[model samples]
Target: MSKKKKIAILGCGWVGNALKTKMEEQGHEVNCLCRDINMDSLVGFYNCDALIIAVPPSDEYLDVIEDVYFSVSLNEAINTQMILLSSLSFYDNDKLIADAEELAKIKDENTVILRLGELMGYDRIAGENTAGKMTNDSTTNYVHRDDVIGVIEIIIDKNVRNKIFNVVAPIQSTKKEIFTQNSKKFNFKEPSFSNIIDKNNSYSSDILCDVLGYKFQKENVQDFWS
Candidate 1:
């Protein structure tokens, strides 16, 4: 059995809470931060074996980071090994890469950024609970939440740090393929689609599987819409 490590997750939203629960199940100690910026939390955060920053990027997110981790001494920031949950949609091209490269310097080299595609899982599939995008032939770039948490655990367990990895399923499918196969199970009408123009920033997980050896548990698109 792998040794248990203490982890401090700085966000307690849906993804954060789920990750915390999963990590706890695996025998790792987890501390979840749901309150506003607090120095006491940062003090505790600096002592963890690793940190997972799950807060989505927004106008004030940077400021929040400054309060939460960045404002601390460089030594303290260096001690906080982090796994940032980022979106692949933001870093999809050359120009975007140039911009994101600057944002990367905010954290120390020990931090790993896992860029996720559209999440698929209970109450979170593209075509269900609301609407879907992409055409019949447009390839779907998504991964289940279970796989996302799985990859995160792999990174922590294997000590994979200081890089960006796309946490998407290797399985490929069209929007219609997803809904058509699951229509009976989910009872959703076949939705229309449009030609998905941008593909440069589409999410995939070559580097992650290559580096960390994570096999996606929910590889099929139509396996879990219940």
Candidate 2:
């Protein structure tokens, strides 16, 4: 039997809440902390076996990290492994990319940073959400919510650390192709694409899979709607 762990998630939002439920189902004790909750609650939380920072990128996120670092430092006996949830969208913004770089420097040897691809699962269908808002010419770099949770569980179970991995599906499909499929399958409106090409590169999950020997449950973004 796998050893039970006490895990603390810093954000109880969509992704975080789902992860909490999964961990609980696996028999791990989980403590969820959100911005609305008292910060004092974190004092004891810092002593957990692992900490998953699922808070989205923002000034408030930085503040949360600063507080966590300070509290962790104070407790010399604490060796809580940290798993920072980042995103591939950061590549589109210089500031977000810089912020991700800065985060990698924190507890460098102990922190495992996961730069996830565009999240797609449940009600968050790439085709449906991107319809009428943007062009569908660029390649998609989506990762299912199940994969995200699975990767985290693998990391904690194997005690993986000091690594940076892109948590995206190995398959790359054009937005237009995915949208067209969704439109036929779900009766969604077909989205238009711009003639202007997107130069952004597609993200690869090779390192994540190669190292963890993990196989994505939902590898095709086109099938994400189902």
Candidate 3:
């Protein structure tokens, strides 16, 4: 077993809270920092072995990073490994990419960035949000909540750093395929596809698998209802 270490997760939302439970299950102490909590509380978690920033993108995100850096500096926790949970939007969204790059500047050699695909699992499924507004033929890039947690565990376990990985399932299914399957399984209304040919936004996780030697527990987004 890997040695137990102290971990801190900022932003205890869906992904962050789930990660906290998984880390605690593995016998590591976890500190959860939610948005409602004061940023000053970051001081207490600065000494942890790892600091995971899983907050979604927003105007307040950079402010959170600033506070975290200030607290880290005050505590002089130079060895604290930092991980930023970014999104695949970084491929097209300049602002989000800039935010991720800012986080990477914190500790170049000690930080890892994961640009996640569409987050799916539990209540968040394919075709639920974009129902009648999307093209049926466009390819999907999705990653399950379990796989996200799984990849983070491998990074912490192996002490992987100084890399940015695309955290997506290996499979690429079309919107029609996923929506059709989901409608049948979950009894949701099938999404209507537009006649317009939209650009495929498929992303690959080759670097993640190659570097970490990690296998996804939930490889198919179409099968991720639970």
Task: Check candidate 2 and list the clashing pairs.
Answer: none
Ten-residue stretch with the least lDDT total in model 1: 93-102
lDDT of 1 at 184: 49
Tell me the tens digit of each residue's lDDT in model 1 across 112-169. Answer: 8887877878776566643343343456777888898888888888887678888877
Whole-model Cα lDDT per candidate? 0.69, 0.80, 0.80
In model 1, the Cα lDDT at residue 226 comes to 40
What tens digits encode model 3's per-residue C-alpha lDDT throughout 1-63? 689988989889999999999999999999886554445353466677888988877777787
Model 1 residue 184 CA deviation (Å) reads 2.6
Q: For candidate 1, give the lDDT.
A: 0.69
Winner by lDDT between candidate 2 and candidate 1: 2
Per-candidate TM-score against the hidden true structure: 0.82, 0.90, 0.90
Native-structure RMSD, model 3: 2.3
Candidate 3 least-lDDT 10 residues: 34-43
Clashes of each: 1, 0, 0
lDDT per residue as tens, model 2, 30-99: 9886553346454576678888888877756666677666665665786788888988766777586557
lDDT of 1 at 103: 55
